[model samples]
Target: MKCLKSLFPTLMICLIVFGCTNEDIDENTVNESSNKNYNSPNYPIKSTTELIVEYQSGFPERKKEDLRKKYNVKRYEKCDCTNSRIEKWEFDPRVDLEGRNELITQEGGIEGTDYQFFYDNENSTPGVSGSTAAGQSDLLISSYIKASNSGVTIAILDTGINLTRLPQSYPFLYGTNSDMTLCEEGEETEVSGWDFVNHDNDVYDDNGHGTVVTSIIIDKLFDEDISDYQILPVKAFNDLGKTTTFTLLCSYLYAVDKPSVSVINMSFGWYGPSGSLFPKFILENPDILHITSSGNDGINNDDNVHYPSSYTSNNILGIGSFSIKKRKEIVEPLPFDSRAMGISLLSPREIIKSTFSNFGVTSVDFLSVGDQVSFYDNNGNHYLVSGTSYAAPLVTAKAAMYYQNGHITPTAITEQLRLNGTLLAYYSLPIYYGDRIIE
Candidate 1:
């Protein structure tokens, strides 16, 4: 079966070559740019931050009106910052005063200069925590009760997954439309995937970030105790972790059509106000679930929540990270890590053991030990890596499990997370961790 699957790609290529003719090729050229629209609005206006503030403040609410009056806020139709408006008096003394003062002095918020604010204090070292290990077992046990991920398709809307790098234990998992029978030594499966970044189907990951995130959700399909799930790979980011709103919009559009895909996992984020391509998708398909990483910027927990996490809709699950050690010890909170809040869940993020950990890089810097390394291959080896990136998958995997068991709809899963998650009081604010408990 495996050998036959390997030959499938070769056979398909040969068929395509023989099936084509000069006229067919010319005809294809005419249809090639059919989807291109030069007049379409450029995605993710570079000045979205200012636009977001305006949109939010412009809402007809009594509170907003009061704030505007008190601050003497003036909405500049166009300001520096990409020809977008800036509200002159919309600042909050409680939240923005200190940061604003620093900005005026040009003394703080400088990317690398503000070490305490910019650095990821959580999981500064990476390795497997007891929570991840236990979570794996919990996934298996949950499978017996419901097979939570079975038949549920999750579209990983991030970087692409390298099917070749997956362990033999999970070889059945193929790329979009790719042949799954021949796990090794075969042409890459013909799995259908779109790259919003390059505007093509070559959604391969130059950086291993997407691969790691995908593994967290899809690992159940390979685990001996639980191998009954499906994952759809959707690439939206490039190697540098940068992606535009257009790419994300394209990815969401694609997932909306995939009947089996009920949930989408997004681990990347930026600073912007709510309302973007994601909300449009939710408004159209109220049943689908959208999960995003609460950003890593070390602001007050609630202050760092990034969109689509901040979108505050029924269909979105905003995820945060908590350090879980052996026997469920909660380590000191990391700086800049988003605090778990309404519709958010906190899971183990510190020092997670995965295939492509950052062991070598951190070890070279004397920040982590090599023994903490989990897996290694031609792809760069990794040690304990920590970020909201890892935390998003933990919640996504649990949601997949829940979906497989028929315990919740994709939208209901978001609500369940909030219901079951732990609530914490920090910095005089209450934050919620949707369903994932430390026990």
Candidate 2:
């Protein structure tokens, strides 16, 4: 039951055995014929009974009230971080939504339903044993890099963070006090992250995905001796790794509300029509760097889009996974002696694309070592997890290091990584800008 890094390659096998299936095909990936086909089988399933509507700037509150009364909204949740421009309205089930889509659009606004997004990785084994505290300490010491401390905060929107175990296990986080959590809801701060799933402030990682993802970011930052940095945990997903667009939007609003938050680490996504409010959220806030996983579906994202990662925002960096010592399929062989036929020769290729990692020439921005990454679960059990989910945090950590050196803008941080990263190519096509973070 010890930490098993060796099983990382077979992580996809575990997911398949566990019955991971693609139930939805996103809009970008769907054929033109399905554009007007709302009832198409490839359409993403709605996760909630709620509908999110974004109104025009300075929209009348009286009109909002009238619309609420007309639509029979049971209650509404604020989807805006700064203002009440966007709201998620929970309509009574008895109300007919036959023409709601068109009516809402005619009200000088756009509306969308919540779609479910899953955590990008799956566990290989059922259990492992170790004190997260000791394992983290060992990890820090082994990956230590000589550098000065810098105060850069990263906000993570995922299955929440392990509040109880994090304070005791990860030295970089706090359990209480002024540095507790940086949630800015209603001009008030909390002791821990805000949980959008249960409508509370308990940011505990029940599914362990958040903890493992957080560990990777912390590991990279700790390696550089960065002690002043802060991590804002925003729990958007539930324990079962199922989350809706409304929940994710709520999480995004909360994360962006904190002005101190410089980067957002989103390791979860979904395949859908790309009509969610998330794309607008990222576009509106260009100050923060958003790093997301491309996906684990081993498909070309250009053809079959993944949310957040496939989002064409300059501020967003979509990351995929790669591994060393992988035997890449040789489409064309290197120049060799004609007599040496059938004898393999050492190709210049040093890394191979992960079999399960999604990629696209324009969608994914970079690739990182996602296989066999050492991480600890929420229950203090060490493990070896693999996915584009883990790969993204590596880039996020590198971006943090760049931010430590005063690279504040997303464009600047991305440029710095590209300049220092290893350029990777496959056959003849260059996959991503910064092939991988050098560190």
Task: Highest lDDT: give the candidate number.
Answer: 2
Over the stretch 150-250, how does candidate 2's per-residue lDDT look in tens digits? 37878898876653444234345422345333444554345445767766545656666777677788877778776667677787877666676666777
lDDT of 1 by residue, 268-340 (tens): 6544334333565566676777776654443332443345565656666655554323223343443332544
Global lDDT scores for all candidate models:
0.42, 0.62
- Residue 341 lDDT (model 1): 25
Point to the candidate with the largest TM-score: 2
Clashes of each: 27, 0
Which pairs clash (backbone N, Cα, C closer than 3 Å) in model 2?
A: none
